[model samples]
Target chain A: MAVVVMGDVVQLLQRQPGEEGPISDALLLAALANGDGNALAELYLRHHLKVYRFLARMAPLDQSHLDDMVQNTFLAVRQGAHRFKGNASVQSWLLAVAANILKQHIRKESRRRAIAAALTEIPLETTTDETPEARLARQNSMRLLGKRLHGMSHKLKTVFIMCDLEGISGSEVAAVLNLRQGTVWRRLHDARKQLRVALAEYMEVDT
Target chain B: MTRCPGKEQLTRAISNDSSAELDAHLMECPVCRDECEKTRKLIEMAKGLPDGHPTSQTVTRIADELRATRPERDLWASARPGYGVVLVAFLLVGAAVFAWNYVFYPPSGPSGSANTNAERRDSPKGNVTASRSAIYTHSIEHKGYAFDEVVSLREGTVTIQVTPLKSNERFMVKTDDATVEVRGTVFTVVATNGRLVKVSVKSGKVHVRPKHADVAILTAGGQWRRRTHPIQKPTAVLPHSPDSGVFPIASPEAASHLTKKTDRLDRTDKTVPAPMKKKETVFQEGWSLLRKKRYAEAANVFDNAVSSSNGKDLNEEIYFWRAAAHYKSNQSEKTGEALTDFMRRYPQSPRMDEARMMYGWHLFNTGRYETAKQEFESVRQSPLPHVRQNAGLGLRRIEARQ
Candidate 1:
């Protein structure tokens, strides 16, 4: 388990106030819990863009599935509001839930694919020439990384994503993943090493 | 040949304290210099993906969906009418309805009248008839409070209107298999078929204890559903306290005074409430780690903050900090995930505008450009001028690329 050390956190906490009042979240939560329609709307207004974009990144670019997952995630939060303990940041916990939801979606998709494989004819692959060269290159890199990400061990990949991709501090990653700070550091180092090795061939192509 | 810094040391040196020793090493060693440049390039390359934005249509659709699926208010309305009277009224009304239906639309099978009568007579406080055909009636009373009640439980559902004996004082009802605890509040508990228990806390806190499980406290506007058996696992109980002995349900004034005294006592001793103290320490630690650019470590601190407290305020703060740390560390996937989570968890957070901006940036970095542009465009509509300005800048950047 990674313990986020005390001294490092204090510095971040000392930054300029992003927003004011400690009681605001509680008040908003209370309103939501009470089934205040306006409160729920207000909450949506505040977070809709962020959550929608996040889902779009994680899922397919198609709006239907992305919208459904995002909607379901919010619905779950609304239903599970009371169970929320103010332990982790509301965002991290929600992300955990979203991640879980994504995992479930992947599992369901895999199952659907398996069922389809058993019952339907296979489709042939087709290449597209519509994307620009630069765009194609960028897409290739993202696809390569995404595929490689799935092959890495859970802990290593999570640390890599949290630190290198998401910009979370090693300590914060430790807290979210419940690993020690040192372990988070070690895993991050190992993950980067693995990625470097695994993507070496791909990087050569780019160069 | 020159000394080459280990990966961890180099990473720490890049993100942590800028010491002269590390600087000196970097200045002297070509290997370290090359490694540093490579690391920088890797980070930049990873972050260079095209951004995307959620369309306005998507945003509107989500808002509409949220409005549609929000929980009904009827759940909390159960707690207000004074427990005893509500219970009695429910019993009377239910019996009338059941008798009317039973007589007018009797099932086409032999009914066990004797057993049903016996269950009706003996079922109250501490006893339940296990037979599938049995209907149980149970009641408990706290007399000095604003409300008192004798609740009748038929099957597994309970109707309650118990008043709070004191502010912040909790009135917990425990059964052999489950407990529905209430405070100065009104609520209802429906334990369907002895397998699942549903609780709606209209006001105050409702703590549910099922058999051997540690108590789960739910506040006003909160509801909980749990299985009777699995949650009874042994690892749930908190350590017993000397002050854990049952206190008489006192008047609201007395309860408030007692609560204050307890707070004072808790303060005098270093034994701060676990939830509050946990938040302070975790927040402090998480913030410090974030400032040092040790994002992984900061995230861990935020995680501890969520696990140690039930306060919504702390949870929201932790989410914001975690999002910031993820963004700073350049973990686009995790950054987006954290922002999404923050939005879902604290949709009403005042810092939502900032979260939206970052989320859009994460999407863009991950090569989801159209989605990023949409998010930025939405931000352009914000009431806050600064937010709108930033959103406009983001939108222009996205559009200009195409």
Candidate 2:
């Protein structure tokens, strides 16, 4: 009897760390289909924090609005559970949903803010103890960094977050954002170059 | 010897997998090295910014919401492995009930073999059995009527004080002679020897019928008599003067009318002996038993009273109480039979009106919708104002469902 190599391809896609050897995604789906609420809860618990963090970074943290986005993400997961084909990891599917929820939240907030000024004012504050010269230098550095990051294109910002902040591999970022791996690499390179030009003075002062 | 890398090539060169050729080019090229170092610092700076983790409360809130929103069946299934056992036990109990009804107490047809002797004895009478002892009597004074109580006419005569007469209220008084229908009034109908039915209206008016005779209306102070021959035209005057041994009355016509009506009837017909005072006590004991919800025992007691009375009127209250007992025990068929028998034997009874109302409801609950509708319609059209109103409501409900 010969085992097909296609089985390995399927296994490679679904492999997760800390999981017992390789439980089939089909078995997890079967448990869910049997009206297993605990299985659904366990699936949610595993990825909800990361999903929330992704949305919070993407959208302004209006406590109430963020809460609604979080709720909507899980609700979509629940309703879309049947459609899950085990092609991708559950974490990727959930992150996709969270991204959509964040996008929706941004659109809604923009419309709402257009009609009225935001009702909740976020209190901003400084959190460092420093001498006057140090404070001035820190302020200049922060301003330069913010101006550069803000000036970068949306594509570059996304690449920077995915590759640098989130520490996801360029390939995984391509998978998550549905971009080509080469495209992701190109965007990160462009963003870093733009930042270097903007922060040239800061780098000179630090040296 | 060196070449400066483009920004894209420089970014790729920082990767551990980049070839030594790319690294060698980067070390020799200051412009490329400076560009790569700045890109590295910028990347580090972006990573150093807040990671944007959710607060603990937010995580807790989301978890709670997920838990609360989870379907109830899922929680039960996950928590308990014993639900299958509980469900099976429930099904077993339901099956047992179904088995008991279909196998042990199968429904009987009109004249089926399943009919018990007691049921046979309770069947409608083919001929009116004349008995001196079994007279059922019911009387209502200022207080209205309770349909379940039997009226006893055994004390030679009983003065039934029908009071607070509401217009159109119908009362059926059954005597050996005929059934008397009263439309609101205080009246006394004395049954002597269970053969003579003499009616005297103290107030209001009463319509009297001697078994097969046309109804005759007797007004206040009016008297009517039923003898062996037939009821003579109602004489306006009293039959005996106040000087004669009877209650003294200011209206001589009324007093004489009552005396004459009582005297004309033959006393020779055997009177079903009046229930002994002790036996009456036992009848009351049975009634108390019914009130206590001891239906089976109460029915037995009522049976004893009826049988002891030689099947005569058998205190109407006894049968009424018996019906109630059967109803309490969920023996709806038996209760229906008892109520029907009560109606047949005491058609003109004061309690008949109430019994019919209750029986209508009982029939409705038992799914005898057509029969219940008929009963309700009858009461709705009844001359009694309260009965008409009650029956109208019941009819409306029945019609609404239909």
Candidate 3:
């Protein structure tokens, strides 16, 4: 066999005959569980962006922290691959693990007693379509919302973020959080009420 | 408006859990209707939050870490030399260990009362505790390593008191249930009846993972539990003191010095006068050769030392090194004979306990489980914690094998 390095293989990127389209996330994870390095690379390429965005929203983390969390979530997937029972979608499972990792990190840093406000400096301009004034309004609302979340308990904030903001269904939130659906709805309601009181000035005065 | 359906039910209604009473209130009361519309708008506003994504550094780091942690079996198999080479290497390590014990502490005959003091001076007297209820505390403080902490891993239902230390060090304590990691913290771990491992931190923090449970980082006043039959939810508790103490031992500093000396001796310049014919010089040359891993040359040097009349005075030490060199040269029978002779002639030797422990391991490796068990039991009462721990692990390994 000839010696081959990572760069030399890039020129041979064409798919071999009969190799089907993009593999399903679950199947790629299953192959990863079998220690297939290629499957791991493919899986990371597919889900790293979605996971990174989720982690950034999940905690008040810097760029390094966001990068580490994404890497940790995938590394965790590799370690716990055999334990992936497939009860939730692989992406949902990854997000839940990322959330738990944040919780542990917060707990270790002695900030569990109080949420570190704006733990994130979320850059607000994600779309070019919105006018500058409109983007500023959204940024202020999010910044105010982040502060309001800091005052709320972890449970209520997680339920609110997943259900009202991320748009995950209440039942799915229950599965991700190991809580009852009624409990999820109740927390979401509590979170929403707190935000209403905290952001009434912004609410009464439109952007 | 008769107090609208309680806050709980109103909250429930936001998720569309419409009770008849709430629906009637919304229909009849304009105030309640306006509140519901405002609440709905609040959720919509939150949903409009901008997306956040990370840079490509995350992907590259993940790939590199995955590659680094790949299983070592493939590399191990591919790196092997021929069968002859492996047999020779194993013999070398076994003999080297044996020679290390003998040369480091030469034997003392029955009347050598003066020699007993030398042995006593080398004995490591750090700390020892009675394993009452199968739970006890052991303090580990190594200034050389990042270890100036005391952590305990207890099996069975026993309460141990651990005192806080004033240093920056980390250490790991393990039992059947979990491994507890401590870094300059005071904590206690208890395993109840060999079925569970429980860790409670009084100050600082500790990382613990039960064999089949989640990794938990426990802060001061936090407790973690892993059980064969888990029932109670793992949670935090207020910190409390049971009992704690400190025992000062200077072994860590001495060990650091020993390591530095060994490194110096092991380096070879390969320019020495031909093997010294004088008996004393022969032993010195043999020791130097062994340090360099020149096993065959060392074996010949030690053999020459033993044959000379002066060798009689240091036969126990010479025999130990001779056995080591033979083992290193893959001469198993000669190695066994040398060890047996040393054991019989110097029963009161300072290294008798260590020899027995090594012989037990040799027996265990050669499938003589019964003899190995006996050898391990003989040294089960060794005062050294490290030796006792090794013996305990060895016993458990045998039982597991069976």
Candidate 4:
């Protein structure tokens, strides 16, 4: 843990244990809570891509408010750093925060529909050049994926994304979501069922 | 007696979270085992999905946002009432007490400072009277300010004197409609008409702002009048003003010229009973009213003068005075039009630079940004140092916004 003195901030007390050579993620977070700018810069370098990936997967074509969502998530990290329990890994905690921010964002039903519709209309920007047939197939699959993913309830969506996409174990997700492992497994099952049906329909249309 | 293992049991086994019972159930049923294999493949596809990343601009923006919110952290921590709260509360109470004492118990004499009373003191006898013509005099000290306002509240040509203790101190003799703000000065503010206050700065400068009107500064040897009531009856002069020789309403110099002409009229036309003013006389009267700050009355006179002088020279003075009257009345559109006409008609006027700055400021205030920038830019190249400095500052302000 490292301490930084700031005006009106009496003292910074380290909570997370420190390490040698390279700072652990938990130690970096503790330093950030203590107002360490260097710790924040390092954490940003490590986690910005993962946070952005989470947002883009959720709201694919909503480029307009994606920056705001990402910024708000990190802002919460700085403000709520003292409350970080470090029970789960820091990556799981960051994903949890990003998910919570996203939940609050799509709480408005109209905005959720608008973003989903927009995502369906615009093809994802592929890294390589895309042929007409490949582009259409890619766009159709992406639309079905986005629709099927968000169509699940937030509980199932969180469990599904954490377990399947991010490679977080069901136990880690259960810890992050404050749920039992059995409940996390049940939600993950429901999400997989809905997604399989959507994928079956999508594959049939393609054939 | 067991049925097929469900999709949930298949998910449990595929994600490696299987209990002994779930594994046995999945292994015993062929359909449940096949479902578990498809679920594993779906999870594998999700793990191999292409990543979507943020641009570098976005990362910097998030860091900047966190930095901006850093200031709110201290406030959030101390939002509750704590140790320093008592000291802050005590200081506020002390400030309130000091304010109360300063307003009601202002000191007497030159050490006293002025506070804006809730209601205007009608006569000096409401508090302090120094024997000569209901005089209201006080000394007040506030925030280390000391001053005296010797206000004579009697009728008929009573001169008021003020002694300002500091350079920034203000003393005023307030009337019903106008507040006469002065520093160390000697001035006479007469109730010229039932609804007008005539301020004659005998020795020093005074700033007089009428009720709901902008301030107008008058220097020594300058004379101006403002209306004391909203409903003013257009009268020539105060009835109580006995010394008509120095009366500002109709200047003695102007009267002399009119008298010399009247003498000629009497010689030429003996039957003329009423000395009716010619159109030239009417225009001169409007110009005289404008110089005296009787703008509403002057505007009417200027309008008549402009209509009559259409066939004649329509002197440059008419345009300038008309614009001045319009500006004082807060008619910005008319003022803009009039000033534009004046600048075109009299490009070589001595007051052109100051007038250009006025027009630019007017344009800026009205949100005509591009035209205002052009105006300020052209004025920034003026030979006059002060004008150039002012225009340069204006351009900088506009540029900062841009």
Q: lDDT of all the models against the reference?
A: 0.55, 0.57, 0.60, 0.63
The digit string of per-residue lDDT tens for model 2 on B178-241 reads 6656544666666766644577777876666665554677778887765342222221111121
Clashing pairs in 4: B112-B139, B112-B140, B112-B147, B113-B140
Candidate 2's C-alpha runs over 4 A off are A1-37, A78-96, A109-130, A143-154, B14-17, B67-402
Model 1 ranges with Cα > 4 A deviation: A1-40, A56-61, A80-89, A109-139, A150-156, A202-207, B1-7, B12-24, B50-52, B72-402
DockQ of each: 0.16, 0.18, 0.19, 0.19
Q: Give a tens-digit lDDT track for model 1, residues B281-301.
A: 676677667546577787767
Total residue pair clashes for candidate 2? 22
Displacement of residue A151 (Cα, Å) in model 1 is: 4.9
lDDT (10s digit) by residue, model 2, range A33-124: 44455555566566666765665444335556666777788776665555555545666656666766655655565644632332232222
Each candidate's interface RMSD (Å, one decimal) is 5.5, 4.8, 4.4, 3.2
Which runs in model 3 stand beyond 4 Å of their true positions?
A1-22, A108-122, A126-139, B1-36, B56-402
Residue B214, model 2: lDDT of 47
Candidate 3 — which pairs collide?
A60-A119, A60-A120, B92-B328, B146-B169, B156-B193
Q: Best-fitting candidate, measured by lDDT? A: 4
Error of 4 at B251 (Å): 97
For this target, which candidate reaches the highest TM-score against the unseen true structure? 4
Tens-place lDDT per residue, model 3, A1-207, is 222122122112334579788666766666666676776677777877777666555566666766776777777777666556655667776777777777777776554433363444545545699898877876788788766665567678777776655556677777767888778777877888899998898788762
Give per-residue CA lDDT, model 4, range B174-230, as digits (tens): 655556777767777665332224667777788776665556777887776542222
